[model samples]
Target: MAVITGGTRGIGLATARLLAAEGADVVLVSRNADEAVRVADDVARTTGRRVLGLAANTTDDAAVGAMADAVERDMGGAHILVNCAAEPAGQKAVPAPSEAQWASLASHMDTKVMGYLRCARALLPGMRRAGWGRIINVSGLGARRTGDVVGTIRNVAVVALAKNLADELAGTGIAVTTVHPGLTRTEKVDAMLEARAKAEGHSTAEVEASMTQNLLMGRLPTAEDVAQVIAFLASPLSVTVNGVAIDVGGGVRGSINY
Candidate 1:
């Protein structure tokens, strides 16, 4: 079974669908109860696999713990966890951010960094008992590049968190890894592009082309593209790739990650 936080949309939703289609019982977690159940039911109907939607705010320790307990009681236990419950990054850059912006950054960390840790802590017991598990952290390419300060920090922190967990869990059957997806084409990105095109008096296609000129692939990856990578990392095939961060951003031009 897989428990995916932030599983109602974007990469999380995509991952849930892919995992369910692959025959894994999936639990879609969101802060909003109605949306979570609705999406889970939709995925179940489409994929013909068991899918449950639960509500939890990852930033809250009690909520995360309760969610984990419910998953164990309702559907055996979670063998895989994908942490993607974070607010979208890309806040306006400031030379010196005000108190509120700084607070926002802290909130991001609480949700992305500490929140990942909390969920892992809650579900790890089942994994340990099963003697095998996969924990995939959904970080971002902002961990590699600059410009978005909050994005960079929180994503980098997630990488650090995954590495630390991987090291500590070495020799155990559990593997922890991080995936950094670049600006992928999700619903949110589509909406943003449409708004930008309207404001700039250009076609949405033109705006997208302008934005993606730096990509060597000449296009943005869809959420499904990223989900494929996550599914691999969540499988037994990923045992050799623990503690590593994989980039699923198609390809960026003129820069090398290594």
Candidate 2:
């Protein structure tokens, strides 16, 4: 079974659906417990696999611990874990910003980076006993250093954590890796573009055009695009592939060491 945060929407939702399609029972975790269950049902119906949706804030340590226990009892111990939950902190103004805005970025880091740590620590015991596990962190393109301060830093921290975990867990059959998805075609991204356009006094098209112009493929990466990479890494085939960040951003100008 796979336990994924933010499993009700965007990349998280896509990842859950794809995993179910590939014959894995999934547990969708999110703040909205009701919505999580609904999405799980939808995934189960679509992929013909058992999907358990649970509402639990990723940042809540107790919540995470309880969910981990539930995962073992309800869906069997989660062999695969995907940390895709975030505070969604892509919004920013280039030149000037406020303290509250900075806190927002910190909050994003707390929910994701710290949340990943909490979940990994909680689930490691089961994985260690079984001698097999897969942990995937949903980082993003420009995670290394893309001129975007908070977002870039957050991604880098996640990638660093995954790499470190992979090294530490060597010979434990636990693979830790980060998948750096490029600009994904998601409602969240669209909303960010709209806000940016308004702030910059440009049309949404103009902002989008500028954003895509940097992509080698000239298009936003689809959720499926990143999901394919993640799906492979989660499989037994990628047991040897560890401590690496796979970039899914249409070959952007800046590259990170994988």
Candidate 3:
């Protein structure tokens, strides 16, 4: 069984779908219970994989605890847990933020960092009992790039947390890893592009073209692009790739010399 947080939309949704395609039973968690159920059913029907959808606000402790219970009750308690739910509200740079900005930044750590730990705390016991498990965190390239201040902080937080947690579980049967995916075309991107178009006096398509041209692949990646890598990591073949940072950006290089 696979439990994916923020599994109702964006990259989270795509990762869930990819796992289902690979024949893993999936349980996707998100704040919108209705959306989760609807999407899970659709994916179950389309991919022929058993899927569970549970409503959860990962930032809330009760919600995260309840989510683990729901998974145990509905989807066999998860043999795999994917921390894909991220708070992107703080994607903008500083100096433009408002008084309520801390909530936005705090929310990211609450959900992506501490929230992920809560899930791990609840689910790792079960996984350890099973003697096999996979925990994949979906942090983005922006975490290391730092061009976008807020994102870099959030991404870096998850990366550090993942590394620390993986070390703690070094000898366990479960494998923990992080995936850094580059620009992917999603609804969020479309909305951003639309906003950019209006602000820059250009069309959405034109803005999208410009954005894609700057990417290494000369095209924006789809949720499917990153999801494929996730499926591979969850596979048995990648058992030895623990505590590692894998990039799924189609050769998108950053400023780092390494």
Candidate 4:
């Protein structure tokens, strides 16, 4: 079974659905119990795979512990973990941070960086016992290229964390990696696009096209596009690939790296 935080929407929800379709029983973890359960039920019905939802605030130690306990009791343990939880970036203003912005950025770090660590540590014992596991951290392209301090710092921290975890668990059966998604076409991105379209007096399609200009694929990636890669990393097929970041951004041209 797999446990995915932030599984109620966007890339997390897409990942859950795809994982379920591939015969993995999924535990969808969200801060909102009702939303998590609702999405879990929907995935279960659609994929005919066992899916459960449990609520937990990643930023809270007690809640994360409870979530780990519940997963152990209900699902026996998780073989895969995908860290996909984060507040919407739109909620915060950036581009030129002020002194007062430091506190907000620190809070963002606590949630994205520390939250991921808490979940990883909580579930490591179970994975160690199972002798096989995959932990995929859903970081963003901001790790490689960014225009804001909040995005860059948090994402780079995730990459660093994943690398360290991979090194610490090198001889074990667990494989840790990070996936960087860019300009993913999700409900959240669509909303942003629409708002920009309205504000700039340009069609939504035009704005979307502009967003894809830097990508070799010439189009924004769908959530499913990134989820497929996540599913692969969670499977036995990805046993040899560890401690690295994969770009699932339809190939950003200027940022190309070997």
Give the TM-score of each candidate: 0.96, 0.88, 0.89, 0.96
**Residue 156, model 3: Cα distance from true site in angstroms:** 0.8
Q: List the candidate 2 regions with Cα displacement exceeding 4 Å.
A: 92-102, 190-210, 254-258
lDDT of 2 at 145: 59
146-244 per-residue lDDT for model 2 (tens digits)? 566677778889989998899999999999999888778777887888988999999988888888887888777878778888889889999678998
Best by lDDT: 1
Model 1 scores a C-alpha lDDT of 0.93
What is the C-alpha lDDT profile of model 1 across 1-258, one tens digit per residue?
Answer: 999999999999999999999999999999999999999999999999999999999999999999999999999999999999998875354443233377778899999999999999999999999999999999999899866677888999999999999999988899999999998889989888899999999999999899889888788899999999999999988778999999899888888767
* Model 1, backbone clash pairs (residues 3+ apart or across chains), number: 0
User: How much lDDT does each candidate structure score?
Assistant: 0.93, 0.84, 0.82, 0.91
User: For residues 92-206, what per-residue lDDT tens digits would candidate 4 score against the true structure?
Assistant: 5565644438777888898899999999999988999999899999998888864777888899999999999999999889999999998788998888899999999999999
Which parts of model 3 have CA positions greater than 4 angstroms off? Answer: 89-93, 96-101, 194-205, 253-257
* lDDT for residue 30 in candidate 3, whole number 0-100: 80
- Report the Cα lDDT for residue 188, model 3: 88
Candidate order, lDDT descending: 1, 4, 2, 3
Instruction: State the lDDT of candidate 3 residue by residue for 204-229, as single tens digits.
Output: 87897787765677677788888888
| TM-score preference between candidates 3 and 4, better one | 4
